[model samples]
Target: MGSEFAEKVILITGGGHGIGAAAARCFAEAGARVALADVDRQAGDRLSEELIAHHRQALFVEADVSEGRDCKLAVERVLDTFGCIDILFNNAGITRRANVVETTEKEWDAVIDTNLKSVFLMCKYVVPVMASNGGGVIINTASGWGLVGGKEAVSYCASKGGVVLLTKAMALDHGKDNIRVNCICPGDTRTRMLVEEARQLDLSTDDLIEEGIYRPLGRVGEPGEVAASVMYLASSLASFVTGTALVVDGGGLAGSA
Candidate 1:
């Protein structure tokens, strides 16, 4: 599957680090021109330079995807640089580990806007462009919690659950336009975000890993593992796959099923 993405243009939000950054490298290695839309200028610029060093086309757009203006401008910048967006990876998201009572209105809004609304905002702008251009692939980064409820994470669960359905709804609404929409439900991966989640739970990274050892794989996942799944969905291999939530959670939800 190496070079299957030759000449494709993929726009990734939250592209500065973790799964987004990993996917950027994967796509670049596969010969895709990648545009990173992220709020972290330093990380984005650094990653872009790395890709360019490897002779890959890469652009970093500083953006807060929760805002419509930023999303629109980011897409425009990608089009201006690459001329087209063959794929859109909505990976920008945040989590607040709190129940409804513990979650303040501001916290809930922040989680919802960043996790759920950003998908809507980016797609709102990119979908029409894809439709007019004859079709494109869109991959959203939802969580395993999106497929099932989790304790002490009401807003996050709600936001990701929304993404799970939103992806399906978009696929149904835009299939005629040839736009494919899907989401990935990842479990506790070893990202900075995962480490941060450990901190939020007042535990060390090791503790977090230990807590997730019950997965059928007996371990958490890696960013590249999840990125591989995204690549599959964006490739011709999954041309017949749409409105699906492909779980890449190391069998974390297998037993629950």
Candidate 2:
């Protein structure tokens, strides 16, 4: 496809690394002004610099997405710099590998806040801007676990499940305003988060990755692969898509109920 995002403004959270960073590059390369928000100042700044070197408009905002104030400030910075927000990618998230019994209150809170509440906070700020602008696209990062149960990952599953439903609710409430809300449910993407899950579960990262490849597609997904789905959902190509969980899971959930 040609540059579908030319002259557009895109805000991506968790843009410091992994899928978020990849999505930032994808949108920027497609000609969007990308504002990257993340808790990691160094990574975000470095990526922003790199994007600018590529002749794309990019800004890095250091903000903990778990806090509403930080979310508001990030959106404000984007608006102040870019003049308007055309796309909002609520991609900031963290994962913890613990069943309900094993998960502590603090850990649960941290995961839920980062992975779920962050979406709510970002939307609270960006939705109004999109409504004022007439229309926009919002893409949230959900997970395959959000749709199906996974062993020893209760909190992660719960948080992503919330994202899925939240996307639907936002789509329903905002469609009249020309804002489309949707989510990508990716499975076993090769990222730091996936490796950390292996460490948390006391399994070798190699073994964990091998097991992930047991899916019908015979391999774990790349961050760039998931980014492609985000691009599709964010662009005009998916104009009719909304309130849907687009699974980019390499058939991991295709055989399931």
In order, what is each prediction's RMSD in angstroms? 1.3, 1.3
| lDDT (Cα, tens digit) per residue for candidate 2, span 1-257 | 65878989999999999999999999999899999999999999999999999999999999999999999999999999999999999998888888899999999999999999999999999999999999999999999988998988999999999999999999999999999999999999888888888899888877667876578899989999999999999877899999999999899999853
C-alpha lDDT score of every prediction, in listed order: 0.94, 0.94
- Native-to-model Cα distance after best TM-score fit, residue 241 in candidate 2, in Å: 0.8
Worst 10 residues of 2 by lDDT: 205-214
| Model 1: lDDT of residue 207 | 80
List, residue by residue over 92-211, the lDDT tens digit for candidate 1: 988888888889999999999999999999999999999999999999999999999999999999999999999999999999999999999999988888778888888887787776
